[model samples]
Target: MNWNQFGYICRVKSSKTLSTEQKLQLCSESHLQIYKDNGSHSELAHNIAWQIAEDEETSQKQTACYKNIPDLINEFKFEHKGWLIYLTAVFIIYCFTSQLYQSFVVPQFVEMYSSFSPSLSATFDYYLTYWYVPIMLLALLLIIIVMAIIKLKNASSLTTTTPFSGMYNILLPRRLRNEYDALIAIIEFPYAYKKGFKATTAETIHFEKCESLGLELNDEFTVLLKQKLMSFNAMAKSYINKLVILYGIVIVVSVYLFVKMAYQPIFMMGEVL
Candidate 1:
C-alpha cells in the first residue's frame, strides 16, 4: 500500500531465502504489478530486496530513505499552499474591483461629470475607455506567459545530462534547491554506497559534485538538507506574510485615490458655479 508498508515487506521478505516472485507476492499487489511491468531491477523495491539484502545496515538506510519520500513531497506541497492561496486572493480581488470600475464607477462618474466639466470628463473618459480593459488583460496575460516560460526552462534544464546544468540549478530558490538535492540523495545513495564510497564521505560531498559523479544520495545528507528546507520554508512564510500586509495597504491606497479622483470633477464644477 504505502511506502512504509511496501518497504517493510521488502525488508522482511528479503531476509528469508525466497524467490524473486515469492518476495513480490508478499508485498502489495499494486506495487508488485507496477514493478513487474517496469522490468527494472534497479527499482527501489527490487534494489532493496536483492542488492543490499545481506547488508543489514545499508538495507535499513535505503528503506528509511524510501519511506521518507512521501513526507518530503508533502512538506514541499504544504510550503507552497500559502503562496497559492495569497496569489488566488489577489487575482479574485483584482477581477472584482476591475468589474466594479468598468460597469458602475466609470459610467456613473462620466455621466455626472458631463453635466458640468466636459473637458475633465472627456479627459477621464479618454484615459479609461478603450485602453483600460486591454491594459488589464495584457498585464494578466504577460504574467502567465512569464511564469510558463520559467517553468518550461526549469524543467528542460533539470532533464539535461550535461554536467554544467548544475549551474542552472544553482539559480533556483534555496528551498527548491535543497529539496531537489535531498530527493536526489535519497534515491541515489544505495548505488553510490555499493560502489565502495563511505556514507560519511558522501555526506560531505556537494550536491553538484555528487551528481556529476553519479553518486548523489544519502540518509544523513537528506536529514541535514531537510533541516535547511524547513528553515527556508519558515523564512519564506514570514516574507510572504509581510508582502500580504503590504498588498493590503496598496489596495487600500488605490481605492482611496480612485474615490478621490471620481469626485474631483464635481468639486471643480462647484468652484466654477
Candidate 2:
C-alpha cells in the first residue's frame, strides 16, 4: 500500500560482518544525526529512512526506506533564513560605512583643492567636478551582481528548485525501480557519497538487474564499490563544521565593521572642529 518506494544497492566486503538490518540501521541513524547537525532537531525522522540493499545479501528481506530529500530541503531553507538576516545586516553596514568614509575624507580633499586652486570659489562645486557618483554607482552595481550570483547558487542547491521531472524520469528507477513496495527512505550520506551513491548502488543493482537484463557482477567492480560508503564520513564532518564556522565569522565581522565606521567620524570631527 506504500506507493512511495526508495532504495540503493551497496557492495559488501567479505570481512564486513554487519547484517543487512544492521547496515540499514547504521545508515538510517547516521543520516538522522547529519540532518540534526544541519538544524534544530525536528520530528521528521520518519521522512529520511534508507532502503539500502547489499550485493552479497540478495536473498535478504528489504529494509523500509523513506525519501526525506523534500523534508531535508525544507529544513535547510529554514536554517538558512539566518543568512538573509546576516546579508541584510551586511548591506546596511556597508552603506553606512561607505557614507561615513566619504564624509570623513571628502571635506579634507575639498579644502585642499580649494586652497590649491583659489579660482574655485565654491568647495562643494570643486568636489562635484570630480563626479564620485559614477564610481559609487559602479561599485554598487558590482556588489548587487555578486550578491545575485551567490543567491542564485544557493537557490540552485535547494533540492526542489530543480525541475527533476525530466532527468528523474530517466535515472531514478534504473537503480531502485525493481525494489518492491517498501517505505521510501531518504538518507544524507556524506556529500562525497553524493556521486558514490550511484556507482556504489550500481554495484548491487548491476548484479540484481543483470539477471533481469542478462548480466553478471565482476570481482573488480565489487572491490571498488565496497570502499565508497566508509570513505566519506570523516571528510563530510570536517567540511560541514568549517563551513558553519566561516559563515558565523563573516556575520560577526560585518557587524563590527558597521559599528566602528558609523561612530569613528563623529568622534574625530568632535575632536578636530
Top candidate (TM-score):
1
What are the per-residue Cα lDDT tens digits for candidate 1 across 128-187? Answer: 754354435534543543343343233222221121244344433554445445444444
Alpha-carbon RMSD, each predicted model: 7.9, 13.4
Clashing pairs in 2: 48-186, 49-185, 65-183, 65-184, 65-185, 66-184, 66-185, 66-186, 67-184, 67-185
> Quick one: best lDDT, which candidate?
1
Candidate 2 per-residue lDDT, tens place, 1-273, comes to 011112222211122477756655644544444434443322222222222334543322222112323332333231334544554565566567656646785566455545643423253452345335434543454444344334322332232223224543352233222211111111222111223444235434443454346342333232322233122222323333444455446546544644454345446557867
What is candidate 2's TM-score against the reference? 0.30
How close is every model to the real structure, measured as TM-score?
0.53, 0.30
Please give the range of 10 consecutive residues that has the lowest summed lDDT in model 1.
155-164
- Total clashes, candidate 1? 1
lDDT of 1 at 66: 52
